[model samples]
Target: MRLTGPVLLVASLTLGLGCSAAQAAESGSSSPTPSTTVTIPPDTTDSGGLSPEEVQRQVARAEILRQQILATSDDMAAAMTKVEEAAKKANAALQAYSEASTEGRDAREKAKTQADIADALQERLDQARSELREWAVSAYTQGGPLAEQLGYLDALSKEASEASNPLQDLNYLTDNRIRSVDDIRQVAVAQKLASMNAEAELGKAEAAEAKAKKAKLKAQGFVQQQQSALDELRTAHAEHVTEAGPLAGLLLGTGDADAIAASERLTDALAASNVSIKDLRLTPCTDASGVFPNGQIPPSNLCPMVGSSDEFLVPDAAAAFNAMSKAYAKDSGQLLCVTDGYRSYAEQVAVKAARGPWAATPGTSEHGLGRAVDLCGGVQDYSAPAHLWLVQNAALFGWFHPDWAAQGGRLPEPWHWEYAG
Candidate 1:
């Protein structure tokens, strides 16, 4: 069956849920969801094919896909609800139609029986009239209209002339007239009841059948629309996944930080001012991965560092380290080995478990703040060539061999290095 106007509109809107950079479905409206613009940082020149604009573009694209997924989810839920409601209505209508059909069938059968009874009563009344007509004619032939319209006694005598008893003659005449009139009245009443039962019941049955058919059609149309929506949703998700890889650097950074400082700043600002999110201050993300658990850590001075490890350091330190590493690699024909660079709180706990008393407690470690590294060359022995080179010329690179780590100092660690930057 053909779909109605309102059902067609729902189908069209379900098909229109796609956007250029985003996807959203407006209930009862066919307008498209608009794309949002974001300003990304300029390229850091050395980023491995991941320029700021490229990253931001990818992020915005992903956001659009995210919106579509959410919209589709809502669409799926609503479709299911519509189908359910439609099914419910259809079931009720079908039940009503069934009841009406049965009632109509029973009513028709009763009407047919009443019609037969009415015919029989009519035949008997006709026979009684014929008998009376003969008597009326006899009365007119014997006398005239005057004699025919005379006393009941005279009429009775003519009707029951062959009766042996006078009382019997009168009783026979009276009974015939009374019984014939009652039969005529019964036939008319029965005919009227039969017509009411057949005609009224037939109309009800037809109307109920039409209502049930309409409800069934509506449910079927909704199911078809839902299936089409599901197909579109799957295709959109595949495209979203295919394009999300450009949002990060060449590699994912393992650096992790507590974000306590940023959290504290957020709390303090909220106490001082009403701290509207639209005008909130942000700190550069402390994590090398450039991600916070949620959007909870707003954007701050993010110093993305470019290197083979794909790690980010504090901005000044990361730039200086990059320069220093390039110089060092130039001289030695290989970069300095890093056993560990930045450690998240969880990583610190793991390291502490593996190296008792040697690993700093989680929050106290400088690595959590993206400022420390542990060297793996013979630098751990304090006498490696890599350490010797840094001792003499590392000052120019903003790196230093700290005093606390010097020989004979308390808790001396030969492999540790901190960036002054």
Candidate 2:
């Protein structure tokens, strides 16, 4: 019924989950889920006053609890991924909409310009036709040019009264009539060309207008898509908060006091969880109403550490440690082994029970808050190559050996390191 070392640590991380499952079992439910709303016990610390016996009972089911936590973590991670994808799509959609809208506006403007040109051309055509009509009317009212010339010639011949030759006068009048007709014919030709140009321009204008309308519709569709994506992102995030919060609370202690005690733990957990520090960021509670005893922060608040199933830390520290570990691995052909991170008050108690004086008092340890980690592999030995390498390179990643863990310090532990940031 008892597990040791990593198994025990892993199990301890899921104590809250195990308790919830136990409740569900009692209620005859085949599946159990953590409560979104955690009722703060009268004593937020002291592990909700769980007796040593009850704690052991939960520890007996550590593997099961660990699996449950992992499953929930995976689900939350998927939801988070969806949210990210949705956000990206939404951004792209918005960009498309902006471009489409701009194009639509330009198209409409061009259409208007073309239409105006067509209108101007039509006006010119109308004026040309009116001038031609006026000339015809004047000719008709004057008894027509040919008829008047004939009449004048007849009168001259009949009178026999000498003037210039009649044929010559008739010829001169004919020449004047031909010149006037030529002028009118030229105007009509020019008007016809203008009308053709105007009609083409109008066609172009209509096409442009149609294009503008299509672009506007497309832009609207994209905008709507972007809005829908935003809504999905919000929903996904809310679900993440609902499901992961309690799990994080169980992994690390919650409430203001535990938060203060485990401030580093919280930072590291947030980092590892991949939650934005600003969004799910935790500040130590100032009032009694908000204090959660050890292992009280929501799972949503803590991040899973790299290369660690049960371990969690703040984002920056987790990133740095992973980087450091990768660098170490590149040099040594093996990853830096991690044994523990982000201890809850309950886990702190268990560790104390198991390791006695070696463990910090419950609720007082950095492991409870998530900023510290205990290493394995050769790093545990001061003279080990891993330890020497860390001494030379770990500080580059904001991780360093504390004075207490130095060779000449109060309790030299080569494997114990804390995140500076």
Candidate 3:
């Protein structure tokens, strides 16, 4: 011991200084000093030769790197979720826009259909109005006072064209307006033209009836005008003939003057009888003037008694026939028909011989008495109304139908009536 205190003090200083150096190194303030005798152990597998503070620093750095990795993973997840949400939103928007476009197209198609219907309706209305106008013009030309009425019809047709439908508009017109205007116009120009033709036919029928009535009236007037002239001629002839019959009887010596006067009286009585003679004539038997003073001969050879020097009816029996006709006419509005008034005795004899048993002998025939007359009604047929009237009424005229039943070998003669005179 070199002096124990000095030695102890130095050792203590050295140790303290060594410890101070180590602390400085640990604190990273300075490097460690190399020592030959002091052995530092080689770094082993179990322990990295690091201080406690360094280890704690290394652990903190590793923790920080792991936290960085976790943060990156969280960020990636968030980004993927955002991309998926955005894609769903875009698809939804696309679907909505497509539906809206389809609805718009459908609405446009419906509008086009409505427009087409409106166009067709308008065309029909125009055609109907044009036809109506043509009809109105035709009615005006047919010469009625309906020209102004036709103008009104044209106005109505214009109004109808303005309407949405013309056929429906036709119902709005009144009955008289339709008949006098629209109906008349359509018929006037129709294919058959039946309405106008019917009116013309009616007019013709009325004119024909008027003409027939006028002709009938003219015929009746002519018949009435001639009645008086016929009556005057008949009266004059009867007076002149009455004086000749008896003078002829005296000249022929068939009777005395008194006898002739008596016969004359009988003739006068017969003339005065209730009879109507439509016509009568007398002629002398001959042209010998002095043979009978009052006798007047007819100036013709047609009389059968013209050569006889005696007075006679022109056919020798005309006086009795005249008297008979007068009686019949006085009792009825009808006149007798002298279908066969007189016959010469020779002619009668010739007829009898020609007809054999069917004809009467000359003097025996009732026709020689000149009391029979035939009759005819105004018409041609011999039907019941005329025949029954004659049968029921002829007896009041002092006339009888000798052939009432067609008996006694005589033909039925509906017109034959004999005066009892």
Give the runs in model 2 whose Cα sits over 4 Å from its true position. 1-46, 52-233, 250-421
> Which stretches of candidate 3 lie above 4 Å from their native place?
1-334, 353-355, 375-387, 403-410
| Candidate 2 worst ten-residue window by lDDT | 276-285
Q: How accurate is candidate 3 locally (lDDT)?
A: 0.40
Error of 1 at 75 (Å): 3.9
Write the candidate numbers in order of decreasing lDDT: 2, 1, 3
Error of 2 at 413 (Å): 54
* Residue 76 displacement (Å), model 1: 3.2
Residue-wise lDDT of candidate 1 within 1-421, one digit each (tens)? 2333432343344223222112221232365355633333234222223445643544454455445545655655665465445433433333343344445545555556655665665676677668667766875687424532344446456655543554654577667667766765675576566555556655655665565455445434543443344455445444433332221111121011112222222223222221111111123334344433211222253354434454445655566666666666666766666676666677778888998887787666766666666776677877778876555435444455555666786778878876643
lDDT for model 1: 0.49
Q: CA lDDT, every prediction? A: 0.49, 0.56, 0.40
Best model per TM-score: 2
